[model samples]
Target: MSDQQKRLQMALDAAHMSIWDSRIVDGQVIDGTVSWSARGAALLGLEEKALTQAFRDFLACVHADDRARVLDVLQDGVQRHGGYDIQYRVIWPDGSEHWLAARAQVFTGASGQPERTLGIIWDITERTRQEIMIAERKELAEVTLSSIGDAVITTDPHGKTRYLNRMAEQLTGWTSQLAQGLDIWDTMPLADEQTGATLEHVAVKCLHQRQTIGTSAHTNLVTRDGRQVAIEDSAAPIWSRDGEILGAVVVFRDVSHERKLSQQLSWQATHDHLTGLINRRHFEQLVAGALHTAKEQGHVHALLYLDLDQFKIINDTCGHSAGDLLLQLLAKLLQSQMRDSDILARLGGDELGVLLPHCPMEHARQVGEQLRQSIRDFHFAWDSRSYELGVSIGMVEINQDSKSLSELLIAADQACYLAKEQGRNRIHVYQEADVMLAQRRGEMLWIARLKEAFEQQYFRLYAMPIVHLREGLESHDEVLLRIRNSKGDLILPGAFIPAAERYDMMISIDRWVIRAVCAHIQSVRDSLAPVEALVEQRRRAPALYSINLSGMSLADSGLQDYITEQFVQYAIAPEQVCFEITETAVIANLPKAQVFMHHLKALGCRFSLDDFGAGFSSFGYLKALPVDYLKIDGVFVRDIATNAINRAMVKAINEVGHVMGLKTVAEYVEDEATLAIIRELGVDYAQGHAVGNLRPLVAGLD
Candidate 1:
């Protein structure tokens, strides 16, 4: 090849240029596949032989949608000697599609008319596909913005409104066409909801800083038609591939409903559903806060605990609905009688708590008297019956000397009990010094008796037989602790148990009980050891003994180990001894009680949750406590024979206990009629004075 020809070939190769020469008068191809044509044809998945028929074949290969357009361009270039640039799709024999950019210029005759066209074509499919995809993604983004719930607006780097979705138009009261070219600040103006002051321009800030900017918490969007809404919005800048801020986009939503719902939920959490008074949980929180303030800032607050006298009689005589009505009426009356600064709460059941902040002792006592008199004067008429009510108020001055809320509450409760005992419808102030409060002298005397009893072994263990109500069920006996007064007269546990539990002496009493019971059980088991066959014959079933433990003992970390050691020393089977605790006790010290019960139960000892369905009993705790029996509280069983409500309560307790795979025990079964009702209710065991009077455990042993 000549140097000139080789240089031309090199230039074509450098530019990747393809040349085509055709006679457009008859559409004849003069030369095909000359400069880079071989390589271009190869890239198109076509052979060089096809170049000979390139004019007809290539024109036919042009995508059908672009064929006529390509023909028109060629006709204008050939006839008027005009230049043309066009991009069209090409299809190979395998049905593969490609894009080609074609440029042509016509060669003119002497008369200045075009005769033939010369064109260069090259494949540009990859770049064309990329551009198409970008357009498609932009279309998708527009559709998503218009379809979503949130309002969207886009702006340019200078904060000019570029686009608005459908939601944005509805919120701003401006159509996309009218909002275009307007400054974004003018299109979307937000102000503080409370202050009515215009907020910072979020779009301008986002665009200038190339970062996202959030609206203030109370941002209220102001619209064209003077409409406003609570909106939480943010603006983020649009960045180009070179990391330049090109524009900004703002997204926002109306959060008015969410804010209202959140406020409603907050209120419900603090107030009682029925009485509309602050619930116990929220009241306790207030007390804790007040305690802290009083200690830190030397503020004085007084707490008053009031109980409706004979509330159970009224509730039992009337239905629960009547009881509720009485409580509501009483709540309203007390609310009216108190000052606005005072806080009142329904601390569950018939108990109400009052907090008087920054009040002196004299004023607090006066307020307590007013509340008491108000309740005593109020007459509640439920159904056809008019019932008179009274209140027992306990007042305590909370100061820096108060150690904790729990202790203060207990002292107040005890003082309220003293008021009720001294005579109903009265108020009593709690005095820490023993001599001042003559009403509490009884409890102090009992404390002395308990000390004397524990020291002289004046405590005796008595067993009362638990008669099996079911025909073939086994029977057991519960051990009851009785104290002997200094005068040698026996005392019931109800008289002194309170005092023992009050001073945290129950843990020591519980240890003594465990030791005594285990010793008695060991002696019985050993007496019958020589004749194993006669052991079952001695009773309807093997004798199982139960002992009661106080709530304070449940909190003893070493109680379980102490029981285990007793079992080891006495050589007695844990199955022969069962521990009984009240539901209130378990609830008070749930973590420790749970650990104690589960540990001893693992060793084959049984547990009974006594006084079930008394107090604020939650069935939710039943699944957590593993007990062998549930003793129905005597309050329900005492009148079960005549009262339908009591019967239903007992029945429900039995059914739930059976469902949980535990036996049920009925207390206060004092007559044939009551025993018949409990037997029909499917109770597993019945224990009362009628079932068997308390007999000395050692004296009863043959």
Candidate 2:
């Protein structure tokens, strides 16, 4: 017990580091055993009884207003295990108010009653006041910076991130906790856009130099996950009152959108907004440069003047948006004809210019003819109407003998005018002795040839087998329509189909195929036993002959009636035929497509949505119309075995079809590996060159 009390007394003595006292409750003050030092008597200015002030007289020193609260706090602390602790004001006899911190512990008897109280008291007015002022200043600084608009960052002297404001955190893709203690340079990486190179550390350089450093133009900050953002900022050293550099502060703003706007404004100055091709002024500048090159360095070049034929007919009927789309599409086609070094531009409305450097007259003519034919073959679809248009291009070759750039441009324009006057779809070379011919003759020849072929029965039917993966020989052949030329040569359908489609000749062709397909089906049915025996193959799935229909035919009011008549005339079952429509055609004429599909479906005919997963693939129309098969586009199926992206696309399409209960047919499966991949992806049918080759639709009749 004595040892315990001695340790307790030592603790109280240590607590009185600056002032105060301790007491043994049973000791007598008159014995002088507890002497108040002379310093304590001097503090009170009383020598008599100064060495022996009763505890109540000491309470008098405590401010009267705080006496009751102090007593209650002490009583509450006396019941606890640690001690009684309080900070309160003390008023000396001289009326001086000072802060005092006091703490005490009470030792209890076996019955838990008070035995002896040991305590200490000290003055703490200066320390408490300083702490409160520091807290208020820190809070004020935090509030001001947090509300600032610009991004702010502060790093330590060692170039580690110490703080990041909200904007800074968003721009850097790093939060305060995650970025703190990380190298500031790594957190806010900067790159020189022009050179694709990293710049020096911003904060470290500022601290070393003790001055602000501004960033240069075309500087981009690389964020945490590697996105480059154009940014503008400056870094300055953070200094203390004594002019000692502590760390650095950086203020930056995101300028990515602003930079893009500036660049776009510059580009719009020289390029057409609609077609994104060089404008008239830029095209003329190129031609002028080409003429100079020919004169000074003996270099040869060519320039072409192209004017659209029948553009007004289509543009006036359809809206201007359609005309703009056609112009943009033609620009892409023109680009396909030239090398990257060649310049193609939209000279004006319905007119274009092409500049070919280091070219002879012969090569320029070929390119000019190629552009002319491409436009002649293109079928422009606009608002449920399809238009066939043409381009009349004039070629002018630049040589050392060329007088001037203005003269060459004039000659090219004159030749182009002649092409347009002659008929609209021909290319004319600006030769001194070249004769004027009627351009109308070119288009007249195609229309006349198509009419002759329709009368001569020159059109033929060919079918490529669509083999079901599980059914083997029990497959359908897709009926392809082809036309024979007068020379008895087999010209591919691509050669004449676009022209026919542009002129609204496909509906007639589609009718002929449906009629022929019925005959083909009947022939196969009559010889099924012998044919299967000849090929040594047995069928599993029911045979259905599939035929393609165009968007124009789908919207034709008379097409549905003509189809009904053909079905009755051929005595063919609707179950034996499948109508295939391109996805683009369906999207273009949705209401007509739905009505046509539903009408045929009512008659037990199957429908296959061909060329799905081609472009703008969407399930938005899937629920609107009913379809049996989703034919994967050849472009996607052709490379699934080797391409990861193709595999993902094919897998996604297959899953969507299966969910809708539609069988999927993979096209362009030309190899065994591709077939393996398609089969693994759960496609129901495989149709392509690998499955079968094109054959005469009527084998025995031919």
Candidate 3:
């Protein structure tokens, strides 16, 4: 061997390299021999005799899977380039495998004629094992990045995204291919919750600092279509092996589901579960906010408090299921009529509240009127019953200079009471000079006392007889509700009704009246003959009983059902029950009132158009109301004997009622002169002082 060959041999032996030498002829290894250092022999499991043969024979010892690839590389170099230097595989006698890196060169004569080739080999098993492990780990990392549950986005130094995981795709609604090479902030727009500023406000700061940053807190992210998705995210600088900083990698999870869950829980804390509207708790918060804004902005807000009129009648007459249906329908109707900015909510059982932000006094009135009109226009049906729902709205525009939330709410509630007092299906706006705050306070106190009376059944029924003017005999009696205070003084309807309506205590009073009237009728079932023989008591046997229906009673579609059930429960004949409807109510919701009237008439009950000629006397209203009697307004009756217009109105109303098969009754008749004029005008019944003083008859039949 030459000096260089001797030196290379000594170095290979000391380095513990496995070595081989091959002689190539005719493009094949003609002869070869192997030698191994201790470690190299362990890698290959072979000694010198194994390699002392044609290299092709030695290659036959390679693992079947790797043999063909190694052979191809060797053959390609021998034929195409006339030389070979490649790393490949080999097999030991025990069928185990190891890698070998070989270098070879062709030996030729001066004329360049092909001759045998010489080559040397080194075992590369440990190096090959490390490479395989590294490749496997790289594959696992790729899989993990692709399949992670939370969205992962990695960006370049320019804030341009370069990687997106599967979760990121779904959350952002973008595929990796589409998201890659795009600026992250531009791709996924996000905004500040308070100011609606872009989240990029801090992005440039993060990029310049090269410092890892977890977003200080959760912020609002907007999806492609502007849906707010809450997210928790953090960013960190990526680096190269040489420590050169790359872009940031941001890891984020769509917390929208979490946010929605929290919002749901929060909403449940302050909202009505059934209607999904703000409840009283939320309402208090809203009113407080409105009052503050009104104070700060120098603008006034309005509170519209609404009570469904006659709602109890519906609830009592129908089942609670029907009542629930009616309430849902009413909620829908109210919501449809309000603006998106208006704060509308179901306060509680048949009551609703509306907060009109930045609303002026006139605008509040308009809104109140709009709600009243909408409710009066809504018609609903259940089974064989059908009716329009009506609302009595009380509105109080914030006196920015004077009122607090509580004061404003009370004022609005008072106006709502007045609306009901005016016979329902109406809107009453609080005016500057309406009532003193102290007076409302006193009225509230009175309502508290009235509630006590209702609970204790301290109310009494006083009868006003309706005497036939010509026949000089009493026929029916109107039952007026009177309350006895602790002082035992009889308080009139006008004195306590407004308070009752305000507190929603009228429903109890109405129930008491119904029960008392029913019990009284039962008590008087057997006194007809003796009462008839009394000279002044002729034709008083069929004294039909009448009790005024509060507006709240009418708003309840169930109230009619309750009354019917009560009548049945008490064995009271339908003919003995008379319902009085104010002219204003009938016209306020003509369609709905018509439906209610139809049901009442179906029960064989009678209807009276009370206070006729007091409102807008549309001929259409007269034609529509299913009234059995027309009660002339006291205004017309009081002056009928003197004022020509008053006389004309009374005569015309009497004619219309008579023409329509209804009896005409004159109200407030006080003297012989007024009585004579009404009789001459063809009025059928006379009431008021002129007819006869009212008194409770004996508990017997006439």
Candidate 4:
């Protein structure tokens, strides 16, 4: 080849192209007149000698599926005296299908008649394979997008909608055809569910930020027909292979049911289901907020604790259903009497709390009275019964002086209790002095009742068995004191002991108990059968009686002499009586207690340090006291089975008592679990309901 021809041939060879030429006659390619370069022959899988071939022969090499279209293109080019470019599949001699692209022009002579055609051909099987794969993937992606359940919308980088899936059409109430090319915000309008304010499109944010953006939980989509649909969605920017911003894809779904359920649970958590009012827990939060405002802004507020009177009577006369109806009616009445700013809540079981913000104490009292009157006037009718209800309200001002939420509530409750005590259907304002005055009044009442019991001889003695843990060890009874009211009801000492102690009557009560106990023991000794007397004499010791003494009695100089007189008068064995003194009493009157205990010890009377571990200084005071037994405080023994710290405390006390040569007793052993634990801890004696039920000392002796 010449130099220019060689360069042209080299360029075609570098491009992997082959040149071909053919003569055209009468608007058709001449048969047996087609020729091509060796590369073209090789691309067709033909021998070198096959470079020149008839037009029909070359057509034979074209794939059967593409041959007709190729021939039509060639014929049309020749007739139109124009050029054509086309791609067609070719089957090589090896039975492998390949792709080729050919371009040719129909050259015209001076007379404007078609003369010849020339073309360049190249193998495009690899590029064609890639294009096919890309088409298939695109088809698959379209199918997948249409099939998914979540509403999907694709937007251009400019935030204009490009495509919408089937779900998107249903959710937005807009067809894909109409949504195309529209702004994404217009197609999928959103607003805040709570505020009804327009929400910025997440797709726009994703496009701007070039990252994923999620819509808030409160977002609601405004459909085409102006209906709102709760939705949760996310938008992610689509990036091109070169990392350029292509568009964004938004995926969302309906969350109406979930949102509804969440709201219901939230409401139930803060509200009382029975009355539809806020519960105590939520009420406290609001009161705390009010308290904060009062302290910070110098604003005055008031809290009212209302307890419904006669509610229990109605509940007991009727069923709980009637009680519930009464409560519901009362709640409405109370709500109606309060201002819009006032918050009312059900503080559990016929009790309601009211919080009035920015109100003075006087105004709060008036409001409380109004609520009380409203409840008093409201008659509730249930199941053919009409009953009048009354409310006792306690009011406390919340101001800079307010200490804490809990203290305010407690003060209000105390005031309410005082109102009920004075008379029902009244409102009482809380004052610091109210608590002390109320306590005094209650103590006075208890004192009067105690004096009546003393004059009437209503005092009674009960005993609980204190059983020895080990076999063959003697068991004894701890004497407990009770009082009989004029109504013939038994009353435990707890109801009156504190008052008796505060008023200096505990010593009198103790003296009475000592004498009564001695007389009872003597009577029991007299009543004993001959066989029982013989058995008692044969035993190691007589039946022992443990008695409790007040701290005041312990300090009385003449108490020991009185006790000795009782013992001698009854001809009772001094060894049979044991005196129980609390840890606090001994600590309070250590010197006097020691002298009295030493005097009693000389007379063969035993002493036990009751409620030993309660003072938390048992070991310290135990060494100084003359005691035979250490009573583990019921506080620790009550939960010794489940509380690790209590168990450890009891164990330590028992071990220390054992080491000090004093027998250890576990008190308040109410259950098998507690009894088992103390037994396992090696307590010497167990006393409580678990060992034996409390019974009248006389009956027990008999």
Per model, state how many residue pairs clash: 0, 5, 37, 1
**Which segments of candidate 1 are over 4 A away from where they belong?**
1-22, 26-54, 72-85, 93-96, 105-115, 118-120, 140-238, 247-261, 284-303, 357-370, 395-422, 429-702
lDDT of 1 by residue, 1-702 (tens): 999978976876686656655554343232221233575565456775324344556677788998888777776666555778989898888999989887878776676655566767777899899999999999899999999999999998899999999999988888999999999878998888889998887788788777899764788889998888888889998989998888999998888877666555566568765577998889888888888888888889999889887676676566454676788888888899888989999987788999999998899998998998888788887777788888988888788888898877877776777787789789888877622454367667767787888888788888888877755546588998887666766666655776777777888988998999889877776776566747465646567899998888889888888989999999878988889998878999999999888899999999998999875454788889999989998867866776665687799989989999998999877677888898888899998766776678877331
Give stretches of model 4 more than 4 Å off: 1-7, 20-34, 46-49, 52-68, 71-83, 93-95, 106-117, 241-243, 313-320, 436-702
Worst 10 residues of 3 by lDDT: 693-702
Better of 2 and 4 by TM-score: 4
Error of 3 at 290 (Å): 2.0
Residues 232-344, candidate 2, lDDT per residue (tens digit)? 87899888899887789988889887787778656756887668899988889889999999999999999899998788667545645467689889888879878999999
lDDT of 3: 0.73
Cα RMSD of all models vs. native, in order, equals 10.8, 15.7, 22.0, 16.8
> Which tens-of-lDDT digit does each residue in 114-163 have in candidate 3?
45545556777899999999998978876898788766777888888787
> Model 1 TM-score?
0.59
By lDDT, the better pick of 1 and 4 is: 4
Worst 10 residues of 1 by lDDT: 27-36
Better of 1 and 2 by lDDT: 1
Which whole-number lDDT from 0 to 100 does residue 248 have in model 2? 92
In angstroms, the error of model 3 at 184 is: 5.0
> After superposition, which runs of candidate 3 have C-alpha atoms over 4 Å from their true positions?
1-19, 25-27, 30-57, 90-97, 109-115, 164-234, 240-244, 251-279, 320-342, 359-392, 395-397, 400-702
Choose the strongest candidate by lDDT. Answer: 4
| CA lDDT of each prediction against the hidden true structure | 0.80, 0.77, 0.73, 0.87
lDDT of 3 at 224: 58
Error of 2 at 477 (Å): 1.3
